[model samples]
Target: MSTQYTFEAIGTHWQIDIKDAITKEQSGELYEQIIKRIALFDAHYSRFRADSLVSTIARAPGSYQLPDDAEPMLSLYHKLYRMTDGRFTPLIGQALSDAGYDAHYSLKEKKLSPPPPWDEALIYNYPTLITQLPVLLDVGAAGKGYLIDIVGELLEHAGIRNYTVDAGGDMRHRTTAHMPLRVGLENPADTTQVIGIVDLQNQSLCGSAGNRRQWGNFHHILDPRSLTSPTHIAALWAVADTTLLADALSTCLFFVPPETLLKHYAFEYLILQSDFTVIMSPHFPARLFTVK
Candidate 1:
């Protein structure tokens, strides 16, 4: 039987089908519109870019008001700041720049060495308002997911329920009774290949491996506590209800040990040890586990 295909948006690979309720021409047009919508939302919501409104707030020091869209994210960011006891912080911009990674990515392809991890240099927090200076917000991990959430909302409002939004390596899946979605886990030692697989149904997944996009022996996953590259685990796979949580969890949980993860999160986990041993949460769906 021929399989059904769902339209995709926001630079994510489209898992579309020639067979759908809408005609081929209509689907193509809708996809194009979605892409344009993605760009519009990105320019407005980005906090890292100097052109964004949040960046304007970051540049200005005292008592700055924000748009409604930015208020929720900025508010939640502060909450995360308190939750991890400063472990998962967005105020490491200066530290990241001083240590290297000043650019969007390493302009010099194949860098000789990875720069050091960033520290939250300074913060100003009150009941409602919070501010930070000298720290650049590299929300690369979560910002895209945030975009996914926004775009997903727009798509849903447009009466398109069966679709997916993937930004970079992060993806959010929302589909009808199509075949189950499958995502592969990359080995931190050699990320070119899939080390494992996970089943997906109306879910979101993000991978943070110390192997791919490396800086010599150093990888992108940095430890906030140690102020250096992560050493404990090879890669991490996190699944959650929201892409925001999935993205942040993938980024923050990578720094701490598995024991710390077990202590805090009640959701499923798939962690790869430095020695290649796998640690999975008790609730992980058995059908998804790949035998390697």
Candidate 2:
């Protein structure tokens, strides 16, 4: 029998399932440790928290030394920043805040502001992040995936070989079980309906929908170039070896094409267009239900 636990963190619900038989006491202890780790991440990375490291850096000017643990996230961000040609940027925090997804988490519509110029505003040297201008650094897109990877490492360190860590729609699973896990894809038009399901094993999946968070004509995913929400695609999902890659790629799918993206990275993807047409990569291992 599998053991399961659920808790709230990172402004979303997280669930952990252990496929092996485990004591309730064991499960409780593991859950506590996971929650504690998540809290630490939030304290450091969450833009919503005024005391967060990201918030502090955003408030300050000049160079700031990043924590030792920030290397993985920063390195990935730097690579993505270069690969997407400024489409995927952590420097969009001001733009996001101006659109009302600020530190308070309230959704008050405001005049949209352009994101900081990537070339002039931000600079990074692994453990050090230098900001020439006052800019809010938002890593929400890839940060959650990195957090999931960290938790998965924690589970591995604990000798738990078969488990699944699910944070909202992003999931990472590793199991000795013969059957692959089935994950549902939500329809952008109707949240209640599952458009399709993906069979996953020992992999990570991240899903992003433009309609997930919206106010007026603006949504969470913004095009840095146009200073507006992308209208071409409604939703996208990517499966990768790690949650971090999957999470970042899900957002990247909006701005970059699969052919262009595959040149630098390897992942399977499925995208739902604004016209309700579903497109999938050749190797996308999922059964997509057509919209009739």
Candidate 3:
């Protein structure tokens, strides 16, 4: 028999579904472990929490040493920062807060502040992060995906192979089953409608929409260069071998076109433009719905 558990963390709902012959007690134990693991990630990485490591670093000046757990994400951000030509940056945390997404999670629209120059904003020496200017570091772009992967690793360590870790729109699955999982792509204009479906197995899929979290004229996804929400793409979805890559790529695809991103990354994507037209990568493995 299969079992499913749901919990809230990092400002989003997390669902873990295990397709296995597990008992109620075993499932309960697994759920508790998952919750603890997610909580650890929140404590270290969540910018919404004032006591979080990321928040402490953002509020302080000069150099700070990150914990061992943050090394992977920091390295990933550095690589993405260069690859996307500053399109994806952790230094946009202050810009996001100025845009009204602050430590309290308030949604009210606020004044837009231009982000510091990418070249002179900060310095990263692996485990040590040094800031030359006043900058807030936000890793919300890929942090959730990284946490999802961590949860998946926990499951694997516990001998759970056929399971799915879904954090809101970010998802990761590993299964030996014969049936392919069906993932619905929601239309940004209408939440109830599915614009496309992806048949996935042993893969990760992450979707981001500019309309999901909006306040006044502001959306969650902001361009560091303009300090404003992007108007070109309404939503995007990416499938990759790792949830971290998929999550980062989904946001990166918003600023950088799929054609340009494809040269550097190996992933399939689907994008819905602000004009309501849908476009998919040449190798997008999803079947689009004709009527949407």
Best-performing candidate as measured by TM-score: 2
RMSD, each candidate, Å? 5.0, 1.5, 1.7
* Model 3: per-residue Cα lDDT over 1-292, one tens digit each: 8999888888989898888778888888988998898888888887888888877777767888877778777787888877778879888888788777887767666777767766697778867778887667888899999999999998899888898899997899899875678998898888988888898889999999987778766787888887778889988999999999999898888788777777777898888888878888887778887753
- Summed over model 3, clashes come to 0
Clash-forming residue pairs, model 1: 5-17, 93-136
Estimate, for each residue in 142-172, the C-alpha lDDT of model 1 and write its tens digit: 6666766766676667566666666656667
Q: Candidate 1 at residue 287, lDDT?
A: 39
The candidate with the higher lDDT, 1 or 3, is 3
Question: If candidate 2 were superposed on the true structure by all CA atoms, what would the RMSD be?
Answer: 1.5
Ranking the candidates on lDDT from highest down gives 2, 3, 1
| Candidate 1: residue 140 lDDT (0-100) | 53
TM-scores across all candidates?
0.75, 0.95, 0.94
List pairs with backbone clashes in candidate 2. none
